[model samples]
Target: MNIRQYLDSTYLKRAIQAGITEKENIKIVQGFVREAIDEQFKLVMVRPEMVAMAKKMITDAKSQVDIGTVIDFPEGRSTVEIKLDEAFKAIQDGADDLDFVCNYEAFRNGQVDLVKEEILKCTLLGLKHHKVVKWIIEVAALNNQQIIQLSALIKNVVMTNFKEENYATVFVKSSTGFYKTENNLPNGATVPAIIMMLENASPLPIKAAGGVRTYEEAVEMIQLGVKRIGTSGAKAIADGAVSNSDY
Candidate 1:
């Protein structure tokens, strides 16, 4: 399989998180953009503030790699207005795709309507701006039933509110790659979780982010119908090298 095109080639860690200076962190993101250009992967996923820089860098390099950003990242507890504002900024900053951390806690708290509304508004924002919209359900934070329910919610909202031709423009992604767990377990995408998402979120594409460290794991997800794979070690994966990216 030509796996490069399916890779998002991600680097979402911040300077403070890595104990580096902010300037150094951005340089790393810049390097990621350069790598994405050289590898011809799908895109480079970064924090919102870096979208414009990545855009300019890709433009100057004469590369076709798109730029994507996260919204309500790691945690989905942000209010809808705040999320939308962040998304608008990212859109203006030249983000080609937007991955939103859905209000998972709200849904789990029996606030299903609020969760559905958040999905509807965010999806509409991305579609109207001509960008792909992906929702990170953070599967590790929920039980199996919650995963199934949330996936169904995304698929239902999209089908009911969006045009049939645009269904593929949105995705039900697996994780944010940054969720903290109590048991020190795997906190990102897993095989069973991806399978659950694929089975539940049908027509909507799946972007399996987090913990997809190797080419074989990524290829397995793709063969199972995952439309996108988000990882920081894309170069190694494409070259058949192994590296356990901390995502």
Candidate 2:
């Protein structure tokens, strides 16, 4: 099967996060962009600062690899206004897909209205510009019930506020690939988590991000009905090897 098109090849680490110099980090991003161009992955997911660089590289190569960036990143604690500002900038910088980390903390605190408001506003901003939007619910940080509720919440917001034709463009994604769990637990997508999202976030697509490591795992996600898989090990998975990427 051609799994490449369903993959969002990713590299979201910063210099400090990756334990490298700033110049070295940039060099890695550059190579990542080029690899996406050559490999023709559906999109290249990067930090906001690298969106324009990825865009330029893909444009120069005349490749079809789309550019994606995260807003509010691993922490979904940022206010809606700040998330909007970050997303707006990413869009202007030529990102074709915007994955905003959902304010899962607020949801956990029972601030449903706040969560709904941000989902609606941020989603509208993305759809208005014809960009694909994915809400990262950070499954690692949420319980099973929270995952179902948040996924359904995002689906409700998209369904209630947007046109039917636009539903597919907005996804309820699984994780941010950056959440830390206690005691070396899996910090990303798991079967139960993806299933909860799939069942709850139906009409809106599902993008299983984080912790997916092998071709078999990717295929299993696909068979279980994930529309996309976001992983730093896109190449390794595509080549049928076990990926060593922490993300």
Candidate 3:
């Protein structure tokens, strides 16, 4: 396949969720969004505190952009109420989508009910605002069984939403860039696993994230059935800094 054509065909979504721990990072994120617009790419801005600023940037962009925010980010350790509140506030702030980090510990501890409840909360909130909600499962932290279980859980959630006539999309995502192994390897999600999850997913879309930093890798992901991408290196990848062989 023609690399550029493949990249363009698949939705190239950029993420700007640099946490609110620093001021300079915020400026850099804003600059990234502006530059992404100049390059004509779809963007998903993900800082909880920077949602407002990100929305403003998207609104002011010369080209169209898809604005999104992250809830229960990197940790996914927040209370359900807190996550719901964050989801509502983000939608109210004009975010087009909500990328929610699933409660990894809950899933790890066999708290499937709690995990489902948290995802349901976000689904309801997104429905109220007519926005899309992508659930980040932090796949790198999960074993194959956990990944399969999460897929089943998400399938059930999608069915429930369908019964309620709620039209929110459930997205299985990889990493938040928090955990890493002793090998200095980043603990983010992978494309192959995401595709496997999607093969078992009922109706939700698969969004490949984390270490996707090159045009070729992006194309390979799309061929694997990923509909959206979440990466901070979108500009670099699109500009051909990273190679597909890196994957």
Candidate 4:
């Protein structure tokens, strides 16, 4: 299998998040972009602020790797208008895929209409711009039933409003790889969570993210019908090495 094709090489840490200076952080992002270009991965998933830089790097190298950026990031608590604004800017900055962290908190709080509206509106914006849209449900934040429900919610919104041909353009992604949990529970994609997503969000593809650190785990996700795997350890996975990064 061409593992590189399924990996979205990722680096989404901020300067403070990584405990580095701004200049040093950019240098790290530069190396990340260079590695993705050289490895010919499916995409480089970075923070929204890094989209323009990553776009330029790929353009200069003539690499086919696409640029993706997160919207509403680790916290899905932002209002829909705020999420849309963030996504619009990312799109204009040359992001090929927009992964929005769905407001799972609201859903958990029984604000179903709010969550549904954001999913529909944000997804429409992405489709209008011809970019792949993914809704990260943040599995670690919810129970199994919540995971299934949220995945189905995203699938329902897309299928109800978008054309069949565009179904593939929307994905139900697992996590942000940044959610903190009590007792150090797995805060990323786990097999059980992925199975629930796949079972509930059919036709619309799934992208397994968070906690997927090795090639075998990645392969398992693909075998279970995920369309993509987002990871900071794309190179390690491709090289058949186990990634020790907490992300």
Q: Give lDDT tens digits, candidate 4, residues 1-247.
A: 7799999989999999999999999999999899999999999999999999999989998889999999998898999999999999999999999999999999999999999999999999999999999999999999988998889988888889999999998999999999999999999999999999999999999999989998898899999999999999899999999998777
lDDT of 3 at 179: 56
CA-lDDT, candidates in order? 0.92, 0.94, 0.68, 0.93
Candidate 1 structure quality by residue, lDDT tens digits, 1-247: 7799999989999899989999999999999999999999998999998999999999999999999999998788999999999999999999999999998889899999999899999999999999999999999989999999999999999999999999999999999888888878988899999999999999999999888888788889999999999898899988888957877
For each of the candidates, give the backbone clash count: 0, 0, 0, 0
Worst 10 residues of 3 by lDDT: 4-13
Cα lDDT of model 3 by residue, 36-66, tens digit: 5666666555566676777788776645766
**lDDT of model 2 at position 220:** 99
What tens digits encode model 2's per-residue C-alpha lDDT throughout 1-247? 8899999999999999999999999999998888888888999999999998888899999999999999998898999999999999999999999999999999999999999999999999999999999999999999999999999999999889999999999999989988889998988999999999999998999999989999999999999999999999999999999999988
Candidate 3 residue pairs in clash (backbone atoms < 3 Å): none
Root-mean-square deviation (CA) per prediction: 0.8, 0.6, 4.5, 0.7
The TM-score obtained by model 2 is 0.99
Clashing pairs in 1: none
- Listed in order, each prediction's TM-score against the native is 0.98, 0.99, 0.85, 0.99
